[model samples]
Target: MKQGLGTQLRHLIELLDGAVQQSYADAGLDYRPRYTPVMRALAGGQPHSVSQIAESAGISQPAATQTVALMLKEGWLVAQPGPTDARQKLLRLSAQGERLLPQLQACWRATSAAANSLDADLPYPLSETLAHAIAALEQRSFSQRIRDAKE
Candidate 1:
């Protein structure tokens, strides 16, 4: 069946999300599939404020605050006074969380490989092109959401 582009992209998204979420679970990490995007945004080893996390996570500020509070309680993150703004709090992974990063990264690699293996017969370039196209669409969706909220 020749699925529509949106349907194909949705399937790809579901597959990737499942793989990543399962990888984290298999590795005994605190897995929040929705938070994966947030993790990626903060993966550069830079401290980000809670509002930054919310923006990057595509979530509400209250939601991000709740999640960050949970992560903090779990000893995965620590909060400190922001360098530029004393009123703002900087959030960074704790030493334990930092140590777990390598394992999580390995899981990501393994999961990605498994996803590729699912369609080994397809040319890799085709998949890469599809991914780029879908990413563009997602960006547009995000923009539209922001625009709608302004009305």
Candidate 2:
């Protein structure tokens, strides 16, 4: 019984994320790989709305909102009412998050180096493979492929 592509992809992500989380813990920093994008977005010192963060981070709005909520609870983020839109809230890194930046940046550099080493060990680079996969999916989505297969 062979595993499906989606399952394999998910397993790979889990494996990588687990390693990353452990590395952060080892460095005395509590962070999740999922938080990287949102943190990066706020690192520029500009406050952003959920939608802006979603677009900048290439994540869904709901995901950004959820991440923001968790970060707020964790004291990693601070939110203020949007100046123009009273209903919208602008988000920025909290003081605690700022304090963690140096350690996080070190981890990021190490992660990049590790990824490069891993890519060198593989026949095809993971980043390139993912880019190609995304392009192929954009050309013909998996949903369309499944429908075509049923014909």
Top TM-score hit: 2
Candidate 2 worst ten-residue window by lDDT? 28-37
Over 51-81, each residue of candidate 2 has an lDDT whose tens digit, in order, gives 9999999999999999999999999999999
| TM-score of each candidate structure, all chains considered together | 0.58, 0.97
**Candidate 1 — which residues are off by over 4 angstroms?**
1-12, 50-70, 118-120, 123-151
- Go through the candidates in order and give each one's C-alpha lDDT: 0.77, 0.94
Model 2: residues >4 Å from true position, as ranges? none
Q: State the weakest 10-residue window (summed lDDT) of model 1.
A: 32-41
Report the CA-based lDDT of candidate 2 relative to the real structure. 0.94
lDDT score for residue 116 of model 2: 96
* TM-score between candidate 1 and the true structure: 0.58
